[model samples]
Target: MKKIQNFFSGFLIIFSLFFVFHSAEAGFFDWFFRFFGKNEANVKKEEIVLPKYYRLGVSSVGSGTVIINVNEGKINCGNECRKIFPEKSLVELTAKPNDNYIFKSWSGCDYTPNEKCKIEMNKNVTITANFAKKENVVNSQQQSGSHSSKIISSSVSQKSSSKSSLVSSKTNNSKLSNSLSSAASSKAPSSRSSSSSSIFSAELMEDVFLMDDDGTLIDSDNKLIDKKIVEKFYTLHPQKTYYDFLSVFPSFEPGFQGAFHSIVKNDVKGIGGPQITSSYLSDSNKLIGVNFLGFGFTSPRIKTEDDVKNNLHYLVHETGHQWLAYIGKEEGFSTATHYTNWTDTGFIRDGQQWSDVMGGSPWKDNGDGTVSEIITNKQGFSKLSLYLMGLASQTEVPDLRIVVPENPQDQSPFNVHVRGEPKTISISDIVSRYGTRIPSYQTSQKDFKMAYILLSKKSNPPTMSQIDAINYVAKYFPSEWNFVTYGKSTINSR
Candidate 1:
């Protein structure tokens, strides 16, 4: 009986071993590894892979040329006509209307609703900027005069990393901060009419429309879309980096970013856009060789009260673009161009759903082979973004991942459903490639200057309701900027 029992036990042990071995071979242990985040594929590599790039082709109509500028003219098209831009790259196109002809309108971009052509190159596409030979082109945008604030929004929800709301009427000094500030100094900008609508008052520019062959965009209430009202505002207040226009034209699209000039083509040293310096002409201007140009048309007529209330993210996202999501591009991180899965706008064009390109999808590592996208309501600029903006130290940034999809250009990585392999971009590699951000975050400028104006169509007075809305928004904007930056930055009209 003892011999039989031993034989049976040995047989059972052998059978169990064979079953376990077969299960292991068949991926039965995969769940365990995944649960523990110990999958072999989950190991993060401190390396960079080439980013997915899409071709941007340009076609000219009439007499002008569209200057395609990206990466400080790497493919500054129009001697080239067609060039490929990396995924998430912001492409700015300006119409150089030869002498008499004015830029008629851009034909290809369904997203660009204003004269400033800021396109997020998500896929291979061509854009056509049309210039018309006009008998008399009154380009009022070039004409000198002051105008008021205007910005437009598609109203996508956003995520903030901070839980505290700092919009109190009486802001305590203890609550204010200057992050990355050295031991001696860290304070909010003195409230010098900072958030007052009366102080940041937008001068009204009545709409200028052409009926008898001026040939600019004239459809919605005959409001001329070709000449941005804010251009005139720039002529008036050339000092401010940003212009907030309370506009009448509901056709206007969104917040656009630009630089006045770049000394060199190196993106790290304020190349395409400045990260650590102020490029615009303000009282506290620095010749960092880069300046940020932000313009938007916010019409309360078009935007609901909820939209106006929640509009801070749009401002934060666009301004953040001035210094974000581009540093790790060489190391395989794609610049995220406002793609979100939750917003099915349902507004279709060309038989397809709206591109839904407005807010960005920042991501995080789940420690497994897969990564979880930082959803809206939690999506502020990442620490990596802050570092690029000269707002955070290198130590604050972590090992960020770039998702390598099965198909590199198979839609944008912003889509949550898009599965891919996670490749980590280490900070050391970024430091090695770009070198440490000069003037470091400790000494970097955290306060920015902005101008606000109210835009009214010619002969149309801005509604009192509109003025109230703008005032309310402007009042809380500093706190909003403060919150989104996680205390790394602030803005002032002064």
Candidate 2:
């Protein structure tokens, strides 16, 4: 009896406290909540973190529309990509910081007009949408069955608005629940619905590589020096070394194979092209066997004049290839130009965004290299197309067969090669002019090192491309490759 009475007394005290707090106009809880509400309402803004010098943009390809919503570290795509049989669309997102976040895609494939892309929402955030258009849709699915239907995932939280209302359990976290609920109720897309089973998905991964804030993707690291900074010595004095105006671009389907094979043959010593991709294997498996150029040109920073120049050059060059791919002329041996083919009308006109640096020019016709014709020459173009069709392969660079020819014997009299159509050099010729010994370069000459070092220590070692650049610079300019002694000031000037 005594225990029961005590328990009842305690319960009564708690209940009375709650009732008083709920009703009291001047209670601590009431005053505290009121103050908080007033402050929150009065505060008209929130702080947004941005890079010192960074830009973010979106580009759409094909007949698809893409809407990206960004807020407080959350991102979503609305109807970004929808596959219409014989009609396809593309949407791209580019970010500068090397941070991790979630991405959700609401894609409508399977030719379902009613099936629109949706987003899973979480937290208070803002989002923007962009769209791209294309000509008549064609069903190339039969030929490219190897391709998977691109999907925008729901790696982040998402919510969808539907005609028939449905209820979802309130999340335990009140703030997150409220944000998600608001997003779902705010807008029902002005699109139709379908029974398609394709679902939106998202995931958090390492920062995307070789993608500029401008949304361009590059594939090589050679651009580091050429794109980062301009060397005053090279510009004024012009000491011609083998690598003057060399510009390397990422190859597409067939071109990718040729480029891969080039690396395997010239860079990766001992690696044989035949062993790279066996015809008996599937296309996806073949990629694994090839010496895919490590994604190098994707570094976000342009530290020097060379970097800016090279990056811009490579950007336009690779974008040209992508442009070709966007159109139907990706496979055939057509000249690289800004001209568009209106086959239906039997006319070809210059593309609106075409430029000489991109398509074909005088460089494509005459150059010193064996595969001359711009980098888009017959050989380069042919190799790329063949590689894509699994008709060719690129192995890793083997160490054994690097050939160093005598300087005087080589055909090209010039020791250095500068920017032009396809920048290249004979190793024998460069070594003779630049000397077998390393040159006097400074560590500051290469800026991506700092970012690469930090990322490597925090994550994986510098990627293959990073390693190659370091090796090349270190071998030719040993004094410049300063060891970064952590927690000590022995080598660092900064």
Candidate 3:
């Protein structure tokens, strides 16, 4: 009977042990499956839904035709134009006027009356290209006969009178002209045009004045000399001044005024040097500033005519800064043209951290102290710098892509690709591919990693497209990235 009781107790104990073990194992399996299932459900929930696309309509007025070019398709309209294009697509329209007609303006489209019009098709858009008949002023004048002749004679007389006034005024300053003419005649032929003679004379006078005065020669302001005097100086000393060459012509192309300014102020070197401050028009982005750096001067010890001629490249470098300041200010960046002290390791020792010249090129002081050589003459402008200055054309700029590996755990390298314009990809797509948190300024680790990767992969000077991509990332994303991101430490910390 006791033996029977012992067997029953052992069986009961064994049964209890088995029940506990099975329960624990089942609980663990349930929790594990639940966690994985939750993740899978989230993945399914995040699926992307493409936006609905709509058509764009284009038309023309008068004798002109409208040619619309979109990423998806192209439409040429002679009279009434209509086409279908994807929503949010960029559309470029060109106006071609028929014979005896000229392009007038664009209607029903938010664009200036340029030969080309560009817009983003967010919804159904209708644009009209207008043209006007070209008026034959010459034919009208001929028809008028005697009256037209009188008007023509009067116009010629006015022009002649203006020319005579200019010549007479210049002749009044005969002392200055004669002095310069004598110096110019020594170098070249005496039988030169009046304009040529004036320019040569100015050049000689500038050289003489620069040599005669010490570096302490200060005009009203402590910076340099007066701009009028400087202009006259450049006119006389046209030998090496690039500004003189450009100013001799009527006007500059759209974006070359900064370049002209740089040429004129290349040799201006005194205690203060050149200083620029910009102010914007009320309620507009139009930038206006008094450029005090236009006058050209130099240190007495360093004021050799040869030194001035040799440093012509400095004008190019400095002009680049002016362009940057103007465009950057207009684009809502800091008005300061030069990089701050925090940005550059080597900067002016006078507690001023401004970049010497957009920090584009390096200037080395010759031990002789006559002139400094801008070493990076071959490297015109960095891609980032060019874009900021509005010098990069649409074709020159490239699209940006952040490439990821198939396996997140894989030790393979990641990269930022700068190529043609990318197809419309939503932010959710980026998050899914690159992970929930993409590199941003807020995420320092990810931001630095991406920046270093781009810096390593970038071309020596970088392309305009590459720079554009970097800029987009910085401006839109959380990164405070820019052209100086990688080279800040290496800048001369003088």
Candidate 4:
């Protein structure tokens, strides 16, 4: 019985070895463990291999300009690109597999065959090859199935390396995305509250200067200085750049033409319009009380009932008159013609305004003689000058001229009784008006020499012959016209 059992065991062992050897040869083990095999069912089938150095160019309809670039190991597109794109909704080009290299389209492209080619984005134009996908095969006219074997071999090697790199890259990218998302979410709440507080603070301030009948917040200089009230202006624009101040002023209202005309005609004299029933003198002396020019600032304290009705207007009007005087007194301002003949009605022009343009602010007088000032006195002149510069779009250099009177006579007659039409005053006309002789007020030798030097320095200053005459007046004619020296230099004696 023992011998029979030993023979059966030996036979069973041999049969097991034979079956194992045959299964390995016939791929029976692979079929049994199909999930782990390298067949189509187990692994992803390879598609057309794309090159490492490749780009996908996209175009769309209704789009202006488009440029995509690979920078800092990332993709960027849209308005960030400097290149301008044609307007389009959809325009795209894709790739296809050939043999060793991928085939790129110059025109309409899709992945599958039999996709109808139609111009949906651009209308009425036949499709043509504007660009190619592959730079190496760009010029080749013919298509071929055969590929460079060396390129294929290199591509396979590169693809293996790419797979490894992609795996590591994906791990890094996943970690980065989580970090950025977390950081943004954490900051969102605090940022939102800050923005809301800023907005609320601004609304509180707008209620203050919301005055102009036109809803405009005008500066003391009469220019539309701000649209929002003072508090809102400072709140919204925490950083006080020139552009911030610019935003406060509103644009000229189109419907207020009649209001502007009435203000110009009634408050300001010498404005060239037809005769009015009001017989206010249009001459220079009457203009003294008229605040043609000045600059100031407004504050919350100005809201007193008395100030609201009268004081504001008085302050505004007076500053306007003073500004007109200053602007007229400037060395080269053609408007000086108006000052030289302050009494002539011809001094007023079609567009000029004494209340609005000159001072920008108009005030009405209360029982108190003291006019309320908005801006501090120190900044008043500078503010007035800035307002004028803004009106004329003057910067760095002012384009205005100031004309001093040669005769210093009162100009309030409303008619021309002088040697010539008011417009006749030119560089040469100044000498004729002065009669080739300097006035008596400029009697200092040093002051006389400085005046001549400054006259020479002006690219288009008064004439040198006129300067020489002015010098003689400063040195010799001491009893006449007690005009102060006009030199920028302060010291009169050598």
Candidate 5:
């Protein structure tokens, strides 16, 4: 009985202790489970994240429309424009001028005035497309003017208004026109005579070759010799005999300064071509001509077609320096000409600007010692260069227009008004014009033919007539051909 009582007493004590502990900390175990549940709820809330977006704004001044494109979305802003885009999106903006208006400049964007603007959308951005009315009276006045008048028109736009006003003065015009005509005529005959005489005909080139024989410094006629003879003479006399032969040619003499010679075995560093000047000074201290020691017209060994072609190429390239000097003096584009380096992808030579070739693209050098046939065969002045040099008339280059798509994946179309009619050209035609093989990129003939068509479609505008745009894609995006052609049906089609 006593043992049973003791057991009951011990049970009462344990029960009392349990009751006290439970009452003191009520819901302790429930709270522990709820803490983990709350942590899981917080994690789920973190998983529900928000996306990021940015704003793009565009506007225009004058008679033009601003076309803005982000991905597949497009907005045509006549006066004001705005849109939202994902971060790091590339937006293409184009300014289209109305009839009788021209694109002047761009503001609030990184782009040339007339060219297309490519923007990378990182933050809220605004851009403006500026335009101006095409001057009709000024254009007419330019057409009727003499060479001096044309120079004034091209070089000094600010003074054009006053010069045009002078055209209306009939009393002054009669005297001015007569004096200008007489002066122009007198200058023309002498200049033409000098150039015609100085031109190196095939026969003259051969004659000059004989004169340089035996490094005799001077020929029997007392004329300074060519290449090695000149080099020998220059070393002996330095200044007195240097460039004496070039003085007779007025075309080469106007901007003549001096030359540099770098002889490497039988070949010259730049193939005996002139190192074109980057400065536009009427009198510059820069090296204008270059002579290779061994490669001269005197070498009797250059009889093959390839040899003749190569020599002619060197002659043209060297003479190009003289033309560049003359162009620089009139148009102030001297700094645009530059030497060809391996990295330059564009056709514009070093130191020359875009307009130097009338927007003609730079020719790429094939490692096998051949350039594009279009460049070599034509061997003519660029349309813009011709205009600057007074070689081409206004009618030669009509209202040229290029239409680029809002998306790079879209087809860019180009149109030119010929005889007041718009002519549409296919991608194949452009490729044909450029040739099937690209020497610079070492593109295979088959690949270039296929890629040219595909790239023409993938171009930002999908269609472009501007030689600048055409050459840009052909040169810079050679690798994107297959992706744009077979991977997708159209540009940005994916």
Candidate 6:
């Protein structure tokens, strides 16, 4: 009788305390409920944690306009503009001057690069876009738009949004759940979705790369850059879903010169993405988007501007892998992702080659029924390669051929003589051999973008010279591509 009375007294104390402070949570509530043979804890006042939000104020000191681009929307700031965004959200602001005005500078931004400003929202911040009248210029055709969608993720995300941003929770510190709730004065995006899975599926690994005020997914010890950092960079871009290809340039050696890096983490196909197919190995059109990662090693290989310029062919060759190399492999005619060479039985006459960017060299049409390699390494795309890249229709692709040598020189494609017969293969033969590309030029992506980064093995940032060298590659890639592709396709790397 004494023991039973003491147990009843303890239960009453716990029940009374639980009801008295009903707004707060306590494990004793569940502990006492167990005595009543109740399996459910009867959670009445479950705690909920909210995501952090911040306010961004934009102002202009001169006569100009500022276009602010967030997750998927753009805001035009005439003179003053203000908005609220969630933490870890990326904001891009571009200044477009009036007819006679010119962009001067930006203030209160992280850093102004290529005449644009970017801000990562973590706290209440203000930015000023300034402009001034042109002094005496004929027509200031100054560009005023973003160059690349490079995402700069902040490792430290626990920063405060406001002073009273803390939430009340139990002692156990239960897992925090965050939701994209409505902000007090936030303008919701009307066009873009919160997720990018509908278009670019990275084996559903997109969320793993995203961040919040709660935590970040980036893992690194000494900040050695790799595909993870590169993937994260593209995953955070505002227009990630709208893009067809996401190219990443690292400063480190990836063992190979370049590649159309895949983002799939498993063996699932059809949505594997880029340089591979979603359905089968034959149907390459199922892949909608891809990631291309490349690197240029320093020294020995590249000591002068000419060497860097010459090594460009290697990078371009790998980029062509997005839709090349396999075109003639199955037919036993084309070389390894390139045109048929001396090793293959396919041969060409002493005539000018169509496109040698992928392979083949300019041959000197010798009068004695033999062609010689005048200069090696053709700089532009072949008509067939262009057709595969979806930049040209099959009707535009003409016949192609491979020049064979008389005296086989140990299967090497160097300063040799093209003194053998020619194997002339028409575009129809290729199309008949290896089925036509499904997503025709009409539906294929024509414009592409790339993000250039200086990856380092150590935590130290890249030197100014290293950055300039990589940037030099970025600068020349577009024009050279245009010259090769006959201005049909556009590529931008900035």
Question: lDDT for each of the candidates?
Answer: 0.44, 0.24, 0.33, 0.24, 0.32, 0.48
Weakest 10 consecutive residues of candidate 3 by summed lDDT: 450-459
TM-score of each: 0.43, 0.17, 0.22, 0.16, 0.20, 0.44
Q: Tens digits of per-residue lDDT for model 4 on 142-240? A: 213421111221222111110122112222222222223332332231111112211111011111111122223344443432222332333443442
TM-score of 5: 0.20
**So what's the TM-score on candidate 6?**
0.44
lDDT of 6 by residue, 284-376 (tens): 222233444443423212223443455565456656656665556544445545665442221222453343555554444456656544432
Full ranking by lDDT = 6, 1, 3, 5, 4, 2
Ranking by TM-score: 6, 1, 3, 5, 2, 4
- Which one wins by TM-score: 3 or 6? 6
The lDDT of model 3 is 0.33
Q: Write the per-residue lDDT of candidate 2 for residues 1-494, one digit (tens) a residue.
A: 99999999999999778667767557655555665685455445765332121112222222122333233232222122121111122223332221121122223222212223333222111223322322342212111332222211211222222221111323122222223223334322122111121121111011111111111122243222212111221232233221212222221111121122111111111111222223222222211111122223322222222332232322223322321322122321122232121111011113212113322212221233222111111111222222221222322111111112234343221211122223333324322432321111211112211111111211111222222232222122212222211111111123
Q: Which of candidates 5 and 6 is the stronger one according to TM-score?
A: 6
Among these predictions, the greatest lDDT belongs to 6
By summed lDDT, the worst window of 10 consecutive residues in model 2 runs over 200-209
Clashes (candidate 5): 20
Tell me, by TM-score, which candidate is best.
Answer: 6
**Residues 1-494 of candidate 1: C-alpha lDDT, one tens digit per residue:** 99999999999999678668667555546755765677979567775443466667787675445666555442323322555556788877776664345677886674665555778878877788887776744323221233332221212111111121222212122211111122112223122211112212221111111111122223454333423333343343445434322222221221222212222112355312443433334434332222222212233222333434454555555555455444443444543333233222123223433221233344444444444443223335556666777887889777655555556664553344344566666777878877777657888777764433444433222333343344444455667777656677876534
